[model samples]
Target: MTDGNPDRPVIVLVHGAWHRPSTWDATRAALAGLGYETRIATLPSAGTDPSPTASMYDDAEAIRREVDAVDGPVVVLAHSYGGIPTAQGLTGADNVTQLIFLSAYLLDDGESMYSRHGMDAPADTSGTFPLPENPGLALYHDVPEDVATQAVADLVEQSLLSFTGTVTRAAWHDIPSTYIVSEDDRSIPTALQEVMAAHATTTRRWAGGHSAFLAAPERFAALVDEIIRSR
Candidate 1:
């Protein structure tokens, strides 16, 4: 689309905690098939970086680098914990025209994953916490068996700082945004996602679990394509 030039806005995908860019393979492929240019922000708080101090702000800055580097319009599509960084990173980015939060957090200024989830304590007290041996039931119960197994095997440890870090600016406050709520999510309860979805300009729902992108890449890509074309 647009001859693969920077004229058309690109879809920058931000993945959730414990996940990396590889998690978006299927969705990215589908988007490419639809002629959408897509990019994935390297999450500092995720991957096998072995860095014990990556915070949410660091992740935000990583995304900001990608956002600021791009030309033309941008649709920052964030999933799960990714919503936090995208919300922070997109602040003051003139090129970003839209935001799409997929089963993700949309916190207010001074809010955090810990506070929003009502978890009195942070999961990464020791800097980073290893992902559970089995996240199938919590995050991938409804996902296809093979996909869920691969995703679980690929999960990385996430920084605890990201869990407790609070947002200084909520970009969604000034940006047009759509939130996709995962109705069957077990990691982030559907009820809570609905509450967060209220902060979005509009909302959509999917009868899937937390790992909706991996479980239903075609559907996710179709929705993203619609958003991009609407602009």
Candidate 2:
């Protein structure tokens, strides 16, 4: 990152399930070099409770703390289940200028994460690791080969509590939202990603896998940079 205008603010990151704030290290370094500040948030993963007592709002409160710290409006990027928190986090955040979904799930009011895909009215409550409570698995076969293998290895069961949690506020409609769809995403099929993200005002496609930030950080960072700089 060369010297950038300090007045433009920065882009903030929110990662998905089974991940941590540290997972965005590479992307954060790339952005900071470009003169942007980034705060990568870690969500509650399987470790908090293998007993499965996590809710998306619980994750959102974690994100909201970061959003509240921004001095100016920011570009909020969410990956996978992280979008649930992002959507909810942006609700009362005056500093949140935009919401960007990266191969993520976006639901409407009263809609739980699983309900969007018709997986189940309420996600399963079974206690399992890696598979969690999602019905028949929500992961897909279209993700890039190398990325998918690592993704599988990194997989951990997300809380059934989060999947079944309902969001009262839908931030995408209120914010100038964008969608960066990964064509090779295996977890969520590309077709479904497109259809589900149709409501975003701006959408871009990338030829990467679900973990593009890990597999291709620079490219993903550049796209995020462009979004933030344009503001």
TM-scores, one per candidate: 0.92, 0.83
Per-residue error (Å), model 2, residue 188: 0.8
lDDT of 1 by residue, 1-231 (tens): 223444557888899999989999998888777777887898888857665568888999999988887777788999999999888878888888899998899998988888897777654365686665568888889889998999888888898878777888999998899998988888888888999999999888888888877888898889887866675
- What does candidate 2's lDDT look like per residue over 1-231, in tens digits? 323456766577888876656667777877776777777666774443445466778888878887787677677899888887788767867778888899988777777776786767443564533553432134424435565465556655566677667778888878888888888876778988898688787888988667677766777789887876665
The C-alpha RMSD of each candidate to the native structure, in angstroms, is 2.3, 4.0
TM-score of 1: 0.92
Report, for every candidate in turn, its global Cα lDDT versus the true structure.
Answer: 0.84, 0.72
Q: Where is model 1 poorest over a 10-residue stretch in terms of lDDT?
A: 1-10
